[model samples]
Target chain A: MTNLTLALDAMGGDHGPHITVPATLQALRLSSFLHIILVGNEAEITPYLSQIETSVRSRIEILHTTEVVSMSDRPVHALRNRKQSSMRLAIELVRDGKADACLSAGNTGALMAMSKVLLKTLPGIDRPALVSCLPAVNKTPVYLLDLGANVSCCSETLFQFAVMGSVLCEAVDKNPSPKVALLNVGIEEIKGNDQVQQAGQLLQQSPQLNYVGFIEGNDLFSGNVDVIVCDGFVGNITLKTSEGIARLLVHQLEKGLQQGFFVRLMAKLIAPRINSVLNQMNPDHYNGASLIGLRGIVVKSHGSADESAYLQAINLAVTEAQRRLPQMIEERLESILLDINS
Target chain B: MTNLTLALDAMGGDHGPHITVPATLQALRLSSFLHIILVGNEAEITPYLSQIETSVRSRIEILHTTEVVSMSDRPVHALRNRKQSSMRLAIELVRDGKADACLSAGNTGALMAMSKVLLKTLPGIDRPALVSCLPAVNKTPVYLLDLGANVSCCSETLFQFAVMGSVLCEAVDKNPSPKVALLNVGIEEIKGNDQVQQAGQLLQQSPQLNYVGFIEGNDLFSGNVDVIVCDGFVGNITLKTSEGIARLLVHQLEKGLQQGFFVRLMAKLIAPRINSVLNQMNPDHYNGASLIGLRGIVVKSHGSADESAYLQAINLAVTEAQRRLPQMIEERLESILLDINS
Candidate 1:
């Protein structure tokens, strides 16, 4: 908790201000040194701000804009048309050094598009990737990257993703020299496609990286690796598939728990613990996915995220901003590239 | 069980005859008319066969093969050498019309290669794909295909998978005109890569096939469609990822259930119900995957499957054999291709 000011897209996400406004107030209350600038339509966002007390309200600032990026809007359209949109303005604040970070629960493609253009990618990085932490068995979260930023990636792009993922993991998790792994169909050398195989070669040659060999999808939560990298197509599907499984299991278990009178009654007694377990299993609970490799911090919340999940996104932004993640990545990449060249 | 004989590669999986033999006996007990030809080393196979009673023992036969395919062996290696391997011989039984179907829990690559070469793909089909039923919210399972059979599939290859998946789903699940979908990163038209988009176009044009549009990974268990198709790479990762999540949730819940005395006592009271729910969630319990598009039936069990899981695989092979899946696919594809050509 270092003192920092962050920008929030209050007009983004499914519920927009309904979820983001409350989450913003909650964040301000929790962090005494933190300040947030809410970007959205003035009339829609002002009502949520009215309930806050004067002392706490002093830390909140609202930058009014009329336009908003809908979920269905194409990335290219959003970039060209929506200059005053809440999502765009939030990232612009970070780009202009008016805020330390940008957090948005908006169209993922649009958010990435705006963030990359405005905040710009860090030097030596070709593109920014979406990185998210997934719950793992060993109490620590596993960082998975390129969650649908670039659908199909080349070998060099995948290599860049690994470098960004490793830097972000080390900076945020406070684990130096974090073990990185490439996600593939099998653990064997000849398992994945050409892109994955070529990337593996690049990683293996980099002595600067703690590059473990291949990891399959089943080991996503095995807690044996710190960072797992793949192209966006596979990564997106893997993340979403895990979410679907979580929902299915929870729904099935709850249905089964309601069967007999005694079992139902017993279920009530352990409802709290069961709910906690379900929450941990739910990927929605881990809401923030950083658009890494950009010059400034940008955290993307799930489009359907509720107030609590939105709050987690804000907290993630705070953490990343405080740690100066972009700077660390810049320094790390510079040295790694130099070493490879030598 | 319509008095069908299945060739079993008893020496294939991690446990070899130890798990497969007990599973075969269990399958025999469940289906009185079903007979199994256990193909493996005579010395190792005879010991398990000796313990069975006289009446049930009549249903079992041993086909000795000393060479067994190791899990690490490549597909080309197994196809070139290891001709007398249990996996190869089991598939040969189906090719020679000695058995109705072939089932193995052996090295997947070897099994597919051997099955494709010996049994051969259907007339219009270029290759065989691995199709497995995944647990959905509805009682009926969803069929997902191309599970690591061909790593990176082309548009035409993906189209073939959809046709094969539809045929198998209709025959095995007994649902006529099953809703077929292509698995993609998004449901939108502009979402996936070239192969997926082109496949979508082909599926849309096929009026004979019940081709529903795209499905995202989160909808895998939604039970909205009967058949979901993807390349081997994505399908394999999705299947294994869900399995990993199931284990994580079950482990987390069990750990939670063991906490307090009162809650622990109640957990024991409902332990049976809880176990049943966990079993349904676990993918291994739904253990059989069909190697479809071949001229003969072939079912694949998990490599580390236990007795119960392996038994499910045997049951699956029996069902496919009884339904004459390959014949159904051949007839269906003939008419569909004729319709498309016209």
Candidate 2:
């Protein structure tokens, strides 16, 4: 029941509104005052809207558009060329302040390209980096920045990401001066190339962070630290890899349970326990990643998101906007970029 | 008994000989022909060997080496200084033709560094890569090269890895022309950097390779391709992240199965099934990464390897030696490098 209204990409995602619509209803049931802006062709969202008409019928607002950003759409061409696309228009609502944030279960590259140009990176913010909220041993998530936004990064950009990631932890998890680590081959001080090595030193020097030394890829989920900083290329691979492996493990478990009647019975007996375990490790629990240091909030869902994933994103956006993290980051890092310029 | 003996670094790995010893014994029990050249101090190995006074023990040679390479030891410094070190001595066996291949569950950096300087990269190979055999949906591992060897890579190096990986796949799996893929963030033909894009073009243009187009991180386990190529930095991150997430998955599963008496009973009933599933996805199965395209056979195991992991390394080295993969790769890629160089 917050003041923020979220634009949900209704026609987007692999499952479209089937999962998205149901997940939306679930979020509405959880919230008292969330005004939803459903952005897709009216005909497509109308049926699902009618289905969830009880809890959200009065609170919801529809922003109809016909253009669909296919998974394989040319990113730059899609944003510029597909002018009236749902993904683009939905983001425009955020730009126009008609909605606080735009959540999409659509093509990632398109969303990033569109959001960056629309919401724009905040002052002194190099780019709108994608942060990944990874489930850690603690109830809190491990915030990893630049998860495939800027593939190529300099030492300074990575350093900036560390700062942004730390601030994000503060905003979302109520952690101030969150522990930060640069992704590297080794945990030692002298590990990695000039970029990561220099970034390591810079994060350490930046008093705004609780800079721990380099963390390897294996340390990401080990509850070793709070924030992990990396270039988009490495981050993307890490995020997708973790997700894919988790999926594989589940698949392997299912395959095991199907081998015999004994295993099937065992699975049935422990189904509740298994469900609780999955609930804890569920990707949805740590779903939304805020585009930290953006002039405005932009939360990207998994390109294959169901309604649950989109709902997580909306909550993330609302949280980020409430914190006003962009202003804080600008205030802190303004001197560095300007000092370099001067 | 097998005609070939393999040198094993007894002091290496997290679980030491407890796991390593059992795993080695497992491999020995399975393989009627493995003569393990136990490389460690006489005092350290004598007790273990004395317990195994079978006929096979007579064939086992205990090489009493004075020095053991600490995981923290500088690679080049250790190789140049510690001539009597276990890892160094292990490689020396391959150099002196005492063992067909050498496997070590010691410091990875030390192994690779020592291996490269001692064993040397194949002619035209700029650097030797630590290629991990990634478990795919196809039930076989896809060879991923440069998994944290040389971080920054040029086009020539990636192309060389593609050749080296293909050769390894052929020799190890007996697949003549393995599907080669360059790991990029996207799946388009022109999706990556100048280096990857150029390599992708070259891979396509080359008649020798079964060159597939670019693959994203998700495709690694998708069974869409056989070999994945990348710079060491990205490869290392991918490998480590995959392991980290896999470990998390096991922990979650174990915790969930132990929630209550009912759950525990179910878990006990399904213990055999779970173990079978775990055995299939066991990291030990893909334990050893051959420093492919090197002049001599050098296998690198994880620094924290268990007995099963070490044993797997021993088995891998034996198989590579049996197939003469290094020799085959040298013959195949040597001319290609020369072609590129010329």
* Candidate with best TM-score: 1
Give one clash count per candidate, in the order shown.
Answer: 0, 7
lDDT of 1 by residue, A133-227 (tens): 87544588899999999988999999999999998888988888899999999999968889999999999989999999899989999899999
lDDT of each: 0.90, 0.77
Q: Spell out the clash pairs found in candidate 1.
A: none
Estimate the TM-score for candidate 1. Answer: 0.96
Off by over 4 Å in 1: A136-138, B1-3, B51-59
Candidate No. with top DockQ: 1
Instruction: Report the C-alpha lDDT of model 1 over B1-342, residue by residue, as the tens digit.
Output: 357899999998889999999998888888889888999998998888776787789988899889989988998999999999999999999999899999999999889999999998998899899999875446787889989998899998899899988988888778888999998888889888899999999888899899989999889988899999998888998989988888888889999999999879889988998999997786666788999999999999998999988998888888888888999999998988888878
TM-score of chain B of each: 0.96, 0.91
Where is the poorest 10-residue window by lDDT in model 2 chain A?
A: A332-341
